[model samples]
Target chain A: MHKHLLLGVEAIGQGAIDGGMSGVYAYPGTPSTEITEYIQENELAIERQLHSKWSANEKTAYETALGMSYAGKRTMACMKHVGLNVAADAFINSAITGVNGGFVLTVADDPSMHSSQNEQDSRYYGQFAMIPVLEPSNQQEAYDMAREGFALSEETGVPVMLRITTRLAHSRAGVEYKPVLDENQLSMPQDPRQFVLLPAIARRRYKSLLDKQASFVKLSEASKYNQYTDAADKSMGIVCCGISYNYLMENYPDEACPYPVLKISQYPLPEKQLKKMEAECDSILVLEEGYPLVEEQLKGYFAGGTPIKGRLDGTLPRDGELNPDLVAKALGKETYVGIQVPSVVANRPPALCQGCGHQDAYEAMNEVLADYGKGRVFSDIGCYTLGALPPYETINSCVDMGASITMAKGAADAGLIPAVAVIGDSTFAHSGITGLLDAVNEKSNITVVISDNESVSMTGGQDSSAYGKIESICEGLGVDPAHIHVIVPLKKNHAELVKLFREELEYEGVSVIIPRRECIQRASRRKRNISRHANH
Target chain B: MKSNIILAGVGGQGILSIAAALGTAALENNLYLKQAETHGMSQRGGAVVSHMRISDKPIASDLIQMGTADLILSVEPMESLRYLPFLSAKGYLVTNTTPFVNIPNYPEYEKVMEEIHKLPRFIAIDADRIAKEAGNARASNMVMLGAASPFIDIDFAKLEDGIREVFARKGEQIVEINLKAIRAGRQFSEENK
Candidate 1:
């Protein structure tokens, strides 16, 4: 039986289980994190002994899922769009290798950069890999596609990409689930050399992958997800993809749309359906959530192709997520303009919580670094990244996970003395350690501050991979015992912390300062949970 | 009948709880519901809003179009006014009068109230104060939901049942306090209306 209310992430998780997936491997990422979390929390998944746990990183997650598939078990790997970049090498290669059982790589794209560094579409990855991609229009579709995605992969013997944008991933609706399937039994590939990627074998595999493209396209054309809904009005045709289809339908709630609509979810362009819509309608309007992939292809070069309109031709804004108002405006409908907001209502950007350990660390660091001037601190992605915000304004750069240490090392090598790097506990584990190792090897004159909150507080306080192990990890990385300093971040310890920061800044070698404290929010939540449990 | 609502508040102010209660109630009434929420970076104390649509018919879009929302339910006064564009001309603005003063530059509470009062239809109440009087200050979200209950298309009793159902895991005392808070908020809105 299906749940009355199911979140999109939950539906995907449930669908994966029902599709007979034996394992789900992932790293914690916004919009994509909940899929793995759902499976981990599920009772059936636990009983089945599914491999649902956070991997070291996206690359590890991807490779592990491939291993599970090699063992002849249906498997899934999930990550946010940027994480796909880290796993891209393996992901593209896996497409040629082909799967023994079933494999699905789900990447959640954050258009408008919601909790992400960039809004790069994941569909390009699918195209680059020469693999099929499924983009669901709604929560129910998310479930259906996930359940069916494994079979699609098994049939083609190639991994499939299930792409979803932020809005659809976070939205909630009722989803009726399919009956569960038992886990696939362990087995090996028929060909012993299938896993090998030698020059000769890779050439053969690549050619075979190229040969599969025609079949993939045919599959898309026959897919129930790709449909051409004919309309009487042929003046303007609409080609809507994924959640954009819903936005298009929202414009015409009561009556059918006058223009022919080509709704596309499964990709490879579904050329047959597109040609049909083109032949019937005068012009085409492409509605896609992310980068104008379909629009660019349809527009091509040298114009004269049905006057294609979309993010390219100002039919809609080129950037940001789509909404019903934007869709209505594109159709020349009157839009609602609400009352102007008073200037008194200032922009309330996200800030660190009161009594946060990062606040104390920033206060002390700022006091010590005041003489060094600004632009010396390179930060990583985490709650500590908020140090770039007001009051403290301590951090200079926040590129990606683990960029802080490496960026600071580069600056130090380029004669920027006393270069400082700030990273959180979880981020250090995620990707910061290798950079630190490089800095240590070079003996760079830099100060690395690991703001140990003991938990990943930014993403709702998930367990930190480096929990209770920061100091040991730093030591293991070969930092001098005397130079590796740990301090309690608090008001009473402010002066001592400043002194330690000054000492580290003046040191000619890599110095590590670990300001350790539990995240106040997580600490309180822990307290509440413990008390509630005690009462129970 | 369809009810399109924009629930707005500062992150961590319990707007999602309000959305959950309404969604549960709407589901019990066998009404179709679609709720689009904001998660991730903005959740770190940024302004957040959830678009909730309830209808006997299917909801096409997860988002509610501007000027189509029947109600602007907010847990913060300034946050309530932030989504005025989403509110229909005939929509009711039901908001808690409390100012979540997390930022240093938060506007004057009186000025926020003044802006809210300028609306054609609104119910402004001190949900925090009422929730405290109801014996649980943490139930302020329930109080705000209660103040908006009269405008919501669902039955008040169903909403109460939703509170019971959602808070059932937290134990009977927690559920009772929230019920009291909802009743207090509903009574205030009734008298003012």
Candidate 2:
């Protein structure tokens, strides 16, 4: 038996390859970023020439995967929960169009907003799209489900949704490997018009999809991932889903848990096993990582006969990720309370790295804008977003990836002169270009600053899609060549940068400022790699 | 035997490396291991931690419960105290004496050390100095791991082997420097004891 210590993301990548996946498409986002990165760096994936490059965004990534699936080859698209929202159009439509080959959409949800804007669950998306959802409780199970999910999808002619949360995506454990499978032979759908979702054909496809729901429920009921294990105690039955099952197990060590358990790793509620557990026990306790989907469903419209204890009933906290201590308390076990940290240990929130280009850009912007006052600078997500914190406190808003440019445009149009937008290079490519075009067309008086770090530095220095193309993209967007300014964000250039910002702030037309500099972290990583190569 | 450890430090300080070394050693001993790490936003020079558990039996949660961690191994002095809540009542707290002062209001270095010293069980070492003496200043994380190695249940030889395995791809010279750093750290702890 071959075993290796792998992260959950790495295991998923290996599982996809072992399951004969032809390509894995994704846009870089935390927890989910490593899935494609692992595949990109894998020797087997490179040898097989798998399509594992980062797409422009999640929407393009999913559509590309769907197009590959049309050619009868296994494919996977991965993104974070928020990225699913961006890709929801293609994702929901794919279910209506069905699939000729195996397809999987793996979404990593961030519980408690660990590295995300909000803790929105993706299982709801699966239910919304009417697709089979697979949730894994451990690294080994993540691997197995990723491999088996494809076969299940091909068997049912529908895409599968493999959902995981932050903890499972970022954690590491030992996973045993299975024999690798060969890629599927190229083929086409039996029906020529299967993918053409015209109104008339779509209605018929909708009915067929509705017909598959019963079979999907049956599959969930029969799946090995969802099981009912018996115990002596009948006062309460426990229902643990996904990672919650592991936290539940943590509370019961050395011996088996007294309560019967319905471990639901596959979706559709696994009604048969849940019904059996409910009948055998007086009450039921539900343990889930995110929202109380099971508890809310079991409770129905009103409080029912059997007590359903979970986040809904306040048996467990309603929000945030679950831990063993919380699980123990839910199980009515006494837990040890650790000591508090002394006050001398101050809060060390994440700050801009020393010598970051954003720091210099912010310093110049802050100096120029101090006379005009605050709240005019709108920033987007990236390392530059850290300016909202103490010391800088320059940016007023951080909504989404591309909201900075458009929000600034709206504010400038609304008569807020010198409305400045701050964004990073990767984010600009991700979704900011169209907003820039809007600014130029409307002749909004705003100064847009694109901090060009030549990398997606916030997410561990992934390759930036906008590298070496930011200035050209801005120029193509119809900004005048004279108004476009590029400056190296350095201490020596601070006076020049401030002068350019003042000039742009004075201009009534849209102006673009490019603060170009390589991220210090990325530069150091490159240096190390070059030095290592020299040593070799 | 089970060892529940909380490895703490600021991002980019190589706390993950310490966890990797211990994880490799645990695997060599045929022990089951689970490690939950902090990634994404917090990794931008913020305080980060990893919950590492190794057991002869199957591990349960990736997270260590409050007051249940057997050891808190840290590479930064202030970062060492951040996870005090995870440490057991009698848990060992091993930390580097150096401070990674990034914030403006980083409490006095002397005060931080005082709090660490006040702990019931603790060992504070100047890992940076020792690592520099070991021929590679960058191996301070290895030095911190060596200082905490005594409190861990895994065999010392397995940890040395783990160092070899983790640095194997980086070449033999890098491996030798890290091993020396580990030995120097082990010597300090032994002399203090």
Candidate 3:
């Protein structure tokens, strides 16, 4: 077998292509964006003409995957954990509606808030939707899970969720290729009313979903990824969930753990193994990467009789990620502490690129907003979110992807006249458009600044769905054509941008100010490519 | 045999290129490897570290445990100290003497150098100047990789092959230049040690 060193996300992309995925839908988000990106550039996927276009948003991406599944083809939708909130409606209902072909939803959770606002776990979504969830312990498992998850989804007539955290998603390991599977022939759902969720039909479908829970548990019990190793020491049974298993093993470098161990990569708590451990061991320790999902479940169902230990019992930190040293301490092993960093080392936080358009725009916005009180600008997620930091601390609030527009409108409605909303172009296309629509519908006295870099700059400059369509999108949404102003965001355009922002802030109705420039990083990359081409 | 390294630098410093070359070398040696990398906002200009592990046997954690890494290979001076906590007591530190002064609070050069001098085992080289001397300042990452290669357990020939494999797509000229850069680096470290 040939081995290729692949990142967790790249392995999933390869797996989906090899497993006969018809399409991969996604909006670029960290630790998850590379899946679709990989597929888009894969030779086999390109030859097969898989549907690998960037979706407008996660909601649209989820719906598109569902539609492809409805047409009897394997499909995968990918997004970051918070992006799931946008697709939660479609995700939850899909479980009830079931599937015709096969579907897998890959949600990458950023534990410790690496590049994200929150460290929310996506496995909870799997349980909430009453579907099978697979968490890979390593990169190879990430590949295998995505490859096999479709068949598992079809078996239960439900969508499968492949959950990964930042560590697993961004980590790289050698993965062996599996035999390629053929795509399902084009067909429709066997039952005409399968996806039609009327009240009466929905009740029966909901019952069907509830009925599948037992099988999911059974599948988890038999899952090859979830293994139980017995040891003579019954003093403590360790339950290492997902990548936590790696941390656990790292603690015992020389040999296996003395205590019996349960490594769970498949969900539903692996009932049979848990029961086996509960009966055999005196106590159980739950080691998981994200929130204490497994520990909390064991505590609740086992009724505290087992003396379970984890984040709740102070065995692990309640928040952030788990490392080998922390896992060693949990296993009652002496942790290795290294040399302390020298006092001369200073803290280096992530900042906007030196010559970024966001910097120029922020400088101008700060200049204009200085006249008004602080906290007037509400920003959305993107590279511009960095404006909340450093020399130009321009943005005030950053709640979600598209909260800036709505929050600004809400504040304007509360008589905080001339509130400003700063949003990135890709984000504006994702969910900011609707908020802009809401503002325009009511003619809210808010100024919406669409920071257009013509790419999703924060997530490494992926093609923005809102590219070349922003001004038209604003006009189409019924914003007055005269109020929509587009300006180049550059040092030379500083005075013009300041003047525009001031004028828009004073407007009585919704106004959009688009500061347009290609991302500096991307521009440089493009320049390098062009020069290389010319030289060649 | 195992080689664990904490590769550190400021974002956009081409550390990933060093990682790419190292991963290629590891694979060439048929060793099991796991490398955890930083992505997203950090690449815009933040402190970043990649935990690169290669072993003859199967590896467990993607992250190297604290005080277990055999080497802390950094492309920036201050970044070398950032992961000192992950370096084993007997491990060596190979770093570029050049400073990447993106942050406002960056420490004085003498202070940073004083900390480096305190390390019992280290090789400090001006990889940018070396790479420029070898004709391609962009190949500075390659030079640093060469400077650290003697510490890594992998074969030097395999590392050369790794660089060739990585830069082959760019053409023979690029490959030749990088090879020259790496050899210059290795020679410097050998003499300095």
Candidate 4:
């Protein structure tokens, strides 16, 4: 029973669980953050210790999932599309070494530069690595296809890629329910060569992978996810993949869309279906979310002058995710352009949530280090970096996740005074630990303000590894125990918090100030839950 | 019946909630629903919109093209006019009378109100006043949702159910206030009728 518009990232996680996954490994990034968060919140998953944790980064998560597969378990490794750029070295070789068990890599792509640096599609990565890719249309298909992806990985002895766009990642519609099919759980790999990528052996495996391509194409043909529906009018046809199928179907009523429609959710470009749609229709509209993967393949098939329209000729938007209206326009619907409403909608960019602990922590830091130059604060991603916004404008640099601590270390080494890095509890575990260790080892005079909110509240409240252990982790990384200060984050505690922040700002060696508090939203939820439980 | 709706407003206006309400209605009616939202920073006073498609059969994408929206639900008059290009030729426009001028160029708030009053197909409701009358000023979004409900195939009971489900966790007082807001909205539209 499916209800609600379950976000795409959440769907991916549910898909994995419904597909009978043994483990999931991930490092959070916007647009792809919800997958791991969903697993953390799922009671059944947490009770099972379903092997969900925010690894140090994409690389660590990729390796962890690899380890799970090495132990003959079905594991899913997920990350934002750019995160694959970080884990590429390992990901590329994993294809050659192959897997001891099923491994699925699910990457969420952000088109239109929504919550991402670049809208680079992960399907290209799959193509480069010569792996089969699956892109599901909706939540149900996402769940069903996730199961198939793992099985396909096992069948081909290769890692599979499941690429989803922003719309597919976040939208929700009813999906026909399916039963979970369990996987074969074997023991750890007995042979060392299963992981060791000796050049000689890898070359042979690469050749064998090429030999398996024909079967992969055949598998695509037989995939239950891909379907061809005959339109009442077989004069024209539309080829839609992933979320684009939703747009195409939503706009064209059954009477309006008499052309045959091919819905593709699995990859390797089913040649037979493409040929059939081409032969049946007078012209074709290629509908896909991110790139021209299908359009390019279909172009090759159309050596004759049957015009194929899509992103290549700018029939659809050359960039950004496609929507139903765009597909309607392509299908010759008089595209509705709503009148421009008056400019009452002001440009209010996101700041940290009101009364956020990070704001209190940053405000105190700013007051404590008034003598330090404005550019001294380096912040990582998360709500803490919202300090770069007005009123609190405490942090100066926020390049990426975990960049704050390391960037502060670099700036301090370059002779900046009071180079303080503000990072969240979740971000510290995600990527700041190594940077902290590096600062200690180098004896850099960088102060790290670990804004411990007890949860990854920015990405919808996943538990952070540093929640209860920030102080211990700082000490374990060789920071002086005396320099590790824990302050309660609140306006009433502003003076004491500022005192600790000042002490850290002035310290000559590596110092850490952990401002700890539960997120207001979480605190409120807990209160309500506790009250409700008491009533029961 | 098949319908596509475009719900537009500023961030924090509960455009998302309205979309969710319609989807809940679709579910209650056993209709296929597909909806997409623009989330994150764009929600901070920036323009926000949700595309919703409801049909008897399976629905595809969340994106709708220009001139194809079956209904345009505008929480603010300006946001309604801004998204008018998406309204189908025969589609109706329901907008709030209040003008929230936070834009840099539109310093004179009355200018926007004047422009919105001129649109022929526009049906304006003072949702802000209705929300206030309902006992909470913040329920303006709910008032707008109520105004749009009557124009579409969505069930009022489902919208009420969604409002209750969303606010129930906040406590009984909040749930009660929101219920009143929805009632006020429904009553406001019905009285005008």
TM-scores vs. true structure, each candidate:
0.98, 0.98, 0.99, 0.84
Interface root mean square deviation of every model, in Å? 1.2, 0.9, 0.8, 3.2
List, residue by residue over A49-99, the lDDT tens digit for candidate 1: 898978878888999999999999999999999999989999999999999
- What TM-score would candidate 4 get against the native? 0.84
Q: Which parts of model 1 are misplaced by more than 4 Å?
A: A1-3, A301-303
Better of 1 and 3 by TM-score: 3
In the range B117-160, model 3's lDDT, one tens digit per residue, is 99999999999999999999999999999999899999999999
Q: Model 2, stretches more than 4 Å misplaced?
A: A301-303
- How many Å off is the CA of A408 in candidate 1? 0.4
Worst 10 residues of 3 chain B by lDDT: B40-49
CAPRI-style quality class for the chain A–B interface of candidate 1: medium
lDDT per residue as tens, model 2, A413-461: 8888879999999999988999999989988999999988999888889
* Better candidate number, 1 or 4, judged by TM-score: 1
lDDT of 1 by residue, B106-159 (tens): 888888888988888999999989999999899999999999889988999999
Tens-place lDDT digits, model 4, residues A1-536: 65645666676777677676788888777677778878878876776678887776788899889988988988999888888987898898888778877899999898986666678878889878888889888877776677667878888888999988877776766665456667557777666776777788777878988898888888888888788888777657788888787777667555546778888888787888888878777878899888787788788889665678899987898888887667877888765465664555344455566677887887787787776657888887776666787777888887777899999999989999779888988888877999999999988998888888898776556667666788888889999999988878899999998778777777799999888888876787789789988865
Candidate 1 reaches a DockQ of: 0.76
Residue pairs in collision within model 3 = none
Which has the higher DockQ value, candidate number 2 or candidate number 4? 2
Each model's DockQ score: 0.76, 0.86, 0.87, 0.44
